[model samples]
Target chain A: MNTLMRWIGIAVVIFIAAPLVIVVPMSFSTAASLQFPPPGYSWGYYQQFFSDPSWLRPAWNSIYIATMNTLLTMALVVPATFALVRHKFWGKSFANLMMMMPMAVPHIVMAVGYYSYFGELKLVHSKLGVILAHSCLSVPITFLVLSANLKGFDLTLERAARSLGATPGQVFRHITLPILKPGLAISALFAFIQSFDETVVAIFISGRDAETLPRKMFDSIREEADPVIAVISTLLFAVVFAGLIAPSLIKGLRRMAGGTPSK
Target chain B: MSAYLRLAGVNKTFGNFTALGHIDLEVEKGEFVTFLGPSGSGKTTTLMVIAGFEKATRGEITVADQSLAHLAPQERNIGIVFQNYALFPHKTAAENVYFPLQMRKVGKKEGMKKAAEMLDLVGLKGFAHRLPKELSGGQQQRVALARALVFEPDLLLLDEPLGALDKNLREQMQIEIKRIQKRLGVTTIFVTHDQTEAMSMSDRIVVFSNGAIEQAAAPLDIYHRPATRFVADFIGESNLLEATITDAATGKAHSPVLGEVTCGAEGLPPLTDGQAVSLLIRPEHLKLSREPKEGRQNAQMVIETIVNYGDNAVVIGHAGDQQIRVRVPGADVVILKEGDSCHFSWTADAVFVLDK
Candidate 1:
């Protein structure tokens, strides 16, 4: 059947990605040179990563900045996307066009613009400056996902809410927010990844104090050039894997908790 | 209020095309007024205006003598039912019914109590916890009706609420709606293009044509004495006869081929002698006989064709130069056959002079 062939194609893709998982243990190399199926698994590199102030400091900074950037981006993106979806007005197309601009242009191109803009504003090297750059890069993804979720929504609920005597704000808080749960989770997850995995924008905007995890990983590759990069990538791959699997698991649990859809 | 809702000089223009114009209607506190017309006749537009979902370009609307122009749809205290039912797919039948009460800040216990009463009123007592999709078309419509009535709105506007049901269910829902609307006695404005639905349920019907009220009257009057040719043709099956005013000799006008007709319509408008005008005659009103009547002067025509629809018969024939159809009660064994001669006669008052 056609369905079986599609599943076979998916299996082929997973089969292709199988050997790449070997890269995870390569960071344990006891020797100075990088080798796959690491020569001897040792706790030395991980011990170096945990105890040494040098290795731990930038890693902490990168995690904090990316987390903060994701939060800030969601704050702006959620309301902007809601307004775009709910109302009809002049220049609506223009607003949608503007929101999509940063995603369509390459991140490196925007990174150059951000670098010069921040430099002239004297904000370069600050944590806030790097956060601003990351927020900009993640916003398009968040807005697009949230907006698509909102457009197909039945607007009569809002009308019914208003007629019921809820103020517009109460309707938005209670009804709109409840219905938007799935989309919110999806958008927040995507936006977090976009900021956390950003390298090009971080390289251009970050100073020594504002370096993110991906930027630090890039610097580590340049200096030592070993399989430690693979360890970090595998760690990130785990996070992405968690995000991808969580939706289905949560949905399954919800389905089990509830019965089938009633007539 | 004497009249629960009233509209005057209403005009609506979507871009350059006028969707509704110069509409006037008054629905009494407990009366059921229907907007009946074909598609694009502004029935839905008029409903939207009354619901406060649309603004009129120039008009006045008063619900219970309160001006509705500045009020929002929620503030208007009106209930709406759409063609699709618009039930919350996520909410159970009981929960959907209770939505409006919750909006008004009613306590949950009281809201649920009232919602259950409404669900029972609609005869969906045991299926209260089921979602909309779980119900049949008729049950879904009952849910929609329950949701609308639970709020006890000042006016209930139904936009073709029974349109999606099959014929049998649609007929059943018609009676159900009529019973419910009468029981509630809430002012109702029901809109539809289905003339049978309008005739069966409406206290008064407003026939719409091209953004204007063609005729607004009781169902029988609108059918028997339509003010326009459009109304006669639209509301029921009518045979339009292009007849000349051959003589106003008896101090009354005689419409040709329509037997010998006399109207107390003294002025006769400007239709002079030999001027062709349309005469509206309902098909069912034509009395067809095989034998010539003793004292009745009737127009004789040969039966051209007979369509035998079970329970009724449509006898198409040529009367003079005009083709006409006569409907008689004969879905059973029809005595009339093609190529046979038949005599047709109608009462003096049955012929309606169309304003053409």
Candidate 2:
């Protein structure tokens, strides 16, 4: 009876995730517009997404924005997280609340706010404008993730480094930065995803010159329900999905190779 | 010669909570001084303040006569070993030792060569390529010590450096650390709560309690002539009996447990003109006897309980309504089972006066 209930629970989860799984095969549709059951299987939309520079340019733009936003978020968040975790100071709680404030405010509202705010600054249709807009959303999540990671950090290691003749900067560089590798990598990847898959923020702040791929996909879906959007969506999902599974894959491979995972 | 390092009127506070209060200390070069205390007694906190991790709220700290108040930990040129060893998980054993030199920006080749030599000194030469996790806990600790010594700092601060090891490993590391510190001739300050560890390693011990220095002296002096009631209670096992000064200013007293006795101290209010005071007597100093205690060799009691702890026996006995313990040692020592009666007696000089 327990096994049957377990199977039923698993089936319910799969049923809830039906739409997401169904969208992947739609990218193979033979017809122009997206339809249920995909009409028939073909690589036409996929080829179109890669071949046409109109779609290609936004894809490249998305790549650039994601990379730059992730890097910028890391640069800002890592040190801030370090200070928040490693040092005691006044207004620390206030700083933490501000860092996590973005996660509380609805992104659509912030996008609207940023849209008007940047437009006043004459930054509405620029790459720097979108970069700044996306960064606002990305940096908070990056800081939150990295902060949680830093909580588990053995602060004694930094002290040990200092006692061994490491200046404050050297301790951060040698002891802190290297041990924070896993957290940094994970945060950067998630930060990239946070900006890459975001449609609402891109819709309000993105411009003709700085049109991100998600905004482009939104435009295509709004104008003429294109199957190519599904293709790009599936490709984006595949990239993120692979990232989520890579660590597990390596662990599984290690087990298969008869090597114990060393702490 | 003067002491190598000293903390004169060193005080520390975290807001209203006093962690260490007006601590005065000194340790000669090549001499190991252990700060012994219970948790929250400011032992590890004192070490951190010395290492510049925690700034003293007031007063001054000096290493070989140089003030260290404003100096950062790196600039103070002190080596520290934490309880956890704190080896960088990402680095190989050799790299861990080389980190200090690398931080000081020594050339890569020289740093690696010196780190290799340190690893060899720690008896971990062949394991240099292994990561910290790849080695045993004891080995990781050795690597940490080697790293701390890599820069050859003027002072070494150890915060319960052997605390994380098992009994056998801890003992082994204690000797290894002592040997290394001796060879290096660094003024070392060790902080630990374990009395046995302090007694085994330190040339002298500073006992702290309630944010103050309870006592500071050689191990034997601390054991024999503790300055306060707290020190005697902290350092070893003992029996404290309420007494009255029968002959004030003549080193004579009358303990309620065993009657009149001669001591080296008198003239305190609690023991004034036959007034009551506390006299602390070490359990081992009291011996078990079959005969009754008489004049000048007076003070006799009866055994209450005997605890056999493999190597020795602890016999707790009653003498005139007061309980006392006698540490009985021998291969064929008579083990007094619980509720079995026996006699107890000790010298008056073994009784210490606590005038409260």
Candidate 3:
């Protein structure tokens, strides 16, 4: 039974990691097109991805749109989460449902809706259109993260601050914002990742001028099987993996240096 | 001199549910008062109203002859130490203490120096840089105390600050808090349901029941001379026997369980003849003996349980249908046994009457 269970675990891990194993190696392949095995390893695709204006412009566009989406999403979600988590009023349940509506509906359906809706607003094929759509899509997960943090926040701290002579605005600046910094960072990261990786909505609204990286990758894959797509995937995976482990890596290095961790 | 902090007919209601019902209280300057009651009895609610968190539906609070009506909590200049400590996790001990001063726009260097001095006063001298989670529970409690006091606010309200600590640590912090409050001479209000904490710390204790103040007096007075049956029963372990005053002049009362009893304790309320009242006999005041003792109010009962502490023991038994508890010295426990018929006696001086 133990052997069978161990085998099952190994199979599950392999199935989950198969994409990374394939994409990472294919990224370094010297093949002219997307192919595996019999292809020699080189940095040719990585060089092309960095040097090509076609790849670089969309990458920069994705970054800009994602950054704007994050800012706009946080601006909308922060206060909404605080209200929904901390207060109750008429139609509160409906408001809560509306906040999570984007997550419930299919992404393709949302893409189609925005494609026409933004077209009428004369915003389609513009960076503003993609940013606005991504912000709406980012709301649910961002709200979930922020509301969970807000709920766990001991309100007594705010009360304590007030008693200690901090005005309402001062309390937020000195106590609430500082304490919620980590949660806010994580939620904003989620928003950025969601916008940067959103393909369907970007393909619909982000036309030639405002094309995001994911839409560009999709177009390129359909037109020609570009190995550069694998390079981009590999680079994004490395960046995200580094971000996830950076905190512990820094802590470990500090420990090795005989410096105390700041809890 | 006028009272330092005063609440005149303060009442709070949440829709239909009354949280505080016509609370009128006065605390002299530099005096330590405690609001003692069970959960939902509105002790904390009164504190919140005073702190401006829960606005009173009616009535007003004044400190130093100034009405706190239009003042926000920040303008009121009151310090509070919460039950959970509520220390800023991101700030060090010194920084936490410096927060109030920073709000007053004190410079960083000077505020930090003052904060360190305050931390030193709380016996956390060298822990200025430690985060709250890095310190022990008692240390966190001291940091909270220092932070609350560093601003030198007009009032300090501690909401059951020692409730989360272990017994030994709780006792230690109690003494520590009392010492700090004394040194600072801040008019402090500590809230707790723990009767012993209220008894040991407060210059005066305001006992709450339901939504009103049952009685407010010095600790011993509140304990020995509780104004109502609820105060008698809640403050300490007591055998509250239902009785009727038979002679108002002689302090005599008749009880179904203990028969005729004389309530001659000093400071007892004036009783009228045929008045329905309760005779409160604290368990420690009752003496357990094998035979009916002479010149004392004696009652016979069958011993059912003996709960032994290290230095003392409580002998619980029944007389007719009423349960009687008698606290005896640990040395006397060997002479008593369960199922043995025993006599519990109290003198006239120990028998206090509650006419409520």
Candidate 4:
């Protein structure tokens, strides 16, 4: 049974990793078009991706929009999550359901809705429009992460701080915010990545001035299958891999510095 | 002497449910008072009200003659060690203790030095750098105590601080806390449901029941003279007998099982003849023998059970439908057995009378 389970796990890993594995090799290929086994290997595509204005513009736009989306999303979701999780009021369950509504709807459906809705607001084709749209899309995941953290938080610590002579604002600064830093960081990271990789809504709303990287990549793949797309994919994959592993590396470093025996 | 802390008619009601009912108490400087009661008996609620976490619906609380009505919890200048200790998991012991000093604008070096000294007072001399999770329960409790007392606030409130410790460790912490409170001379209020803890660690105990104070008195006084039947039943083992006052002046009361008995008249309210009352006989005050004893109230009972505690044993028996308990030394249990009829007697001074 154990051997069978191990084989199943290996099969699952290969299934999930096969596409990613292909993207890295394709990024290093000299092919002019999509191919499984590249005709040859070269750094030509990487150079093209770096020097091209069309690609760089969207990459910069994505970074700018994602950063703004993260800030705005955190500003709105942090307090909303606190209110939803830490308080009892009428229509609370309904409010929680409403916060999660954007995530539940299909992205294509939201794209259609935003195409007309943002058009009416004259926010289409702008960085502000993409940021506003991405902030909406990122709220659910941010709220989920933050609410879970807030739920596990021992409120007695706040009370203890208050009893120890900290005002409410000071308690938040000294105790609540510091203790929740990791959760807040992870939640903000999720919001940034959510907006950076969101393609459907960006394709519908971000026309030329605020074309996000994902929308550019989507159009490139559909039109010409640009080899630069592979380079971008590989770089994105490397970033995700680092993000996944950084937490454990940090924990290990902290343990070594503390020098205390673990339980 | 002027009271250091005063809670005057403080009442708290959550919607329709009353959590504390007209709680009025005063504590002198450097006094350690324990609120003793069962769960949901308003002991913890009273502590919360004093800590300013729960606002009293109707009354005033004052410290050093200043009313605390408009003050927030932080403005009250109080320190509290919660039941679970509530130490910040991210902060080291020294940092946890240094927090209050830091808030008061103390410099990093001086605040941390004061924190280390407070840790030393709690007997955790070198544990300053360890995080709360790295410490054991007792160690964590010590860190919490050091943190609460380091600021030297006007009052210290401990809400069942030793509830998590083992028996031996709890006893040790009880003494440790008492010594620290005395050394600091901080007006302290400790809350616990453990009667023995209240007896051993408190200058006075306030017994709570159903959102009201049952009685507040010294430990021995509460044991010897409980103000109500609930107090009598809660504080210690007592065989309460329903009786009627035969003569108030002579302190005579008549019970079904033990006919006309003499009781202590000290502190008893004025009683009329034929008035219904409760006669309290503490188990330790009763003597057991095979025959009736001379110069004391005597009654015969059949032993129903014997609970031996090595040093002493509680022999439970019944007399004509009335249950009676007698506490005998362990050596004396050799001659007694279950189902055997025995005579139990108590002196007149041991019998306490309570009016219904």
By TM-score, who's the top model here? Answer: 3
| Model 3: number of backbone collisions | 0
Candidate 3 C-alpha lDDT tens digits along B1-356: 88989999999999999999999999999999999999999999999999999899999999999999998988899999999999999999999999999999999999999999999999989899888988998999999999999989899999999998999998988898999899989999999999999999999999998889999999998987888889999998999889999999988899999999988759778778999988888999999888899988898999999999969999999999999998999999998989999888999999988875
Decoy 3 TM-score against native? 0.96
lDDT of 2 at B217: 89
In angstroms and one decimal each, the interface RMSD of every candidate reads 2.6, 2.7, 1.9, 1.6
DockQ of 2: 0.54
Candidate DockQ scores, in order: 0.34, 0.54, 0.72, 0.65
Cα lDDT tens digits for candidate 3, A1-263 = 99999999999999999999999999999888899862699999999999999999999999999999999999999999989998988999999999999999999999999999998999999999999999999999999999999999999899888888899999999999999999999999999999999999998899999999999999999999899999999999999999999989998999889675454
TM-score of predicted structure 1: 0.85
Give the TM-score comparing model 4 with the true structure, all chains together: 0.93
Worst 10 residues of 3 chain B by lDDT: B263-272
Candidate 2 per-residue lDDT, tens place, B121-179, comes to 88887888888888999999999889888889898888888888899999998899889
lDDT of 1 at A202: 84
Question: What local lDDT score does residue B132 receive in model 2, on the 0 to 100 scale?
Answer: 87
Which regions of candidate 2 fall more than 4 Å away from where they truly are? Answer: A1-20, A36-39, A86-94, A245-263, B248-250, B264-277, B289-305, B317-321, B330-335, B354-356
Which residue runs does candidate 1 get wrong by more than 4 Å? A1-12, A15-62, A82-92, A222-228, A254-263, B14-17, B133-136, B249-276, B286-308, B313-323, B328-350
Which residue runs of candidate 3 sit more than 4 Å off their true CA positions? A1-11, A253-263
Model 4: per-residue lDDT, tens digit, B105-197? 999999999999999999999888888988999999999999999988999999999999999999999899999999999998999999999
Quality class of the docking in candidate 3, CAPRI style: medium
Q: What's the candidate order when arranged by decreasing DockQ?
A: 3, 4, 2, 1
